[model samples]
Target: MDTQNSAGTLYIVATPVGNLEDITFRAVKVLKQVDLIAAEDTRHSKKLLSHYDIKTKLVSCHEHNEANKTHQIIAHLKNGLDIALISDAGTPSISDPGYKLVTAVAREMLSIIPIPGCSAAIAGLSVSGLPTDSFLFLGFLPKKQQKQKQALEAITNQSATLIFYESPRRIKALIDNMRTILGDRKACLAREITKLHEEYIRGNLSDILKALEEKEVIKGECSLFVQGQLEQKTIDEEQLEKIIISRLATTELGTSDLARQISKEFKVSKKQVYDTILKSNQIDS
Candidate 1:
């Protein structure tokens, strides 16, 4: 209710990730009352709007056009047209569109409202059944496998639980890679979150990999959570071997990125990580 002024407000509304009924009453009310709704996918959001009988006008605000659309939205707001910003699902700007628009609006001294609700990351973490004392939300790994491994290698020795968003197509590969890099840590894969076909597979990386292998073809987006390395404050030589072997198996980086990352992580020189890889006899010199 931050729209007490005549200047239009920008409401960052959170819609359901999967279940339509998961939306809050306040969100529904704002969506119905807003002058305009800047949606990530106007076509996809139409279903939700129609379902709720909200007749507010919608404008596309996806990644490809967010910059241009931000100015248009601001013009409307300045003209005293309250606008609601929403993504196809969940809250906007959480690995989705809406950041630029929010920043632009903030500079204009506009009232930017937040209507928080369900998020796939939080939903997956709450039931991950792992130690959630501290966690990291890695939105998505790099598309390049080596870059992804490099990113993983950087945090392999961290003490916080790791959460990642992965698509179904690459779910198997991600597990295989994680199994190699993170060792056999406890993990959970939450699929089709908040939907009818939602499923949670809880176990170690190997267990989940085997379970996924048994499937014909997995469906839906997945939220993977991995327990952190806590018991061993420091990585032992044996643990380093496992880490090296795993990265070699899944990464295309050969030894460069891995070497640089592990060297920095373990407080050693690049030569050390390179020497470890050479000893593993996996990569050529």
Candidate 2:
């Protein structure tokens, strides 16, 4: 391959997340033909390249050196050098570092092509036995408890399945927090994806937490898929009014505060609770 002749095109390649066989035929061919290959972790990618007998030159392109490497990659592209960007696993720039380089190259009107293939997040979710029509891919949660809690709360009422990437160390804490905010909703913890030890733990949030607690320590990377809300049975307006009025009577809090708490507890709108409170007050008056 002539390095000088192959300049200008940037190939964003998707490598196998776990199983080497998951790689696409086109991805392998592009990787082989590119002048240079930029990777998240060269050593990790080396194994994949070695498996496929790909001899393309590898360069380090990851979160740490992304800003610095972006210029170098663009320089290669400007000079008509074709380059391939790959992550340690899965697709580049999907919660990875290829974004900065891709964005920079695109601004210069350079050709960038995607060689799509395996992605653990999407692969796991596809087989998760959860809602697939709509989903929110929250790549990774904050490490801090409060931030994670706030993050989970922000999406608690979403009607779509929530997909998240989690580290083995923080997965327990993540599950614990989900239980606190999202109740005991069903979730799937898919780990060691597509590998020999691949596993998926499917159950309510509490059960998954307990299972993790019993294990010595989880080893593989994880992708969590949480089921969304199911249809709710309609409660009679009068019955709901009675329940709210009676609960408010036993509490000393103001009507608005009481209504807010009831709304959250019952998964009903605050306005509905407020209207019930007003009706109760009118009847008493």
Candidate 3:
């Protein structure tokens, strides 16, 4: 393909997340026909290439060297050499390497195409039995316990289903954090997806935690789909009024502070609560 007059195309291909047969035919074709293949791990990708008889040259493009390789990849694309970008598993750049290279290619106005296929996040969500209408994909959380809890707290009010990827070692901790910060909502832990020993544990967060405790050792990578925060039932005006009065008499919380606390707890407007508090004349406006 002599596109010397014009820059070569950059193909973002998707590979199997687990099962070798999960890749799309288009992905295989692109991999074979491309002038070069930029892989997250050359050794890891070699096995997949060998399986399909693809002899295209491979270059290492992982997190450590992705920034440095981005320039070289762009140069190749400019010199009329079509290239394909793929990760060890699933599509590149989705919580994986290749984001930098893809962005560089796009900035250069080169033709960029996607030969999409398997994705673990989507696969796990499909079988999670949670609401599919809306979802938020959080690939992984911070390793520190405090940071992880803070991250979960930020999403405690989200109504969309939450999808997270975790390793077997930390799956237990991640589940516990979710339960503590997000409440014991329903969840599904999809492990070893699309593989021989694939398993899906479905139930409340507490149930999943109990099951994991019983296991001798948790194996394989895991994708957890957790139910989002549910809508809080509105508190009756009379009940709300009484609570406001009781707080005013019992606590030192001022009108503004008390209104904020009550509003958050009951999912009502802060102004509404504040007005009710003012009506009681128990706290100064």
Model number with the top lDDT: 3
Q: What is the overall TM-score of model 2 with all chains considered together?
A: 0.82
CA lDDT for candidate 3: 0.87
Per model, state how many residue pairs clash.
0, 6, 0
Off by over 4 Å in 2: 1-7, 231-265, 268-285
Cα error, candidate 2, residue 115 (Å): 0.5
Q: Cα RMSDs of all predictions?
A: 4.7, 6.1, 6.8
- Once fitted onto the true fold, the runs of candidate 3 whose alpha carbons sit more than 4 angstroms away are 1-5, 235-285
Residue 234's lDDT within candidate 1 is 55
RMSD of 1: 4.7
Predicted candidate 2, C-alpha RMSD: 6.1
Error of 1 at 245 (Å): 14
- How would you encode candidate 3's per-residue C-alpha lDDT over 35-97 as one tens digit per residue? 999999999999999999999999999999999999998898888899999999998999899
lDDT (Cα, 0-100) at 113 in candidate 1: 85
Angstrom error of the Cα, residue 148, model 3: value is: 0.9
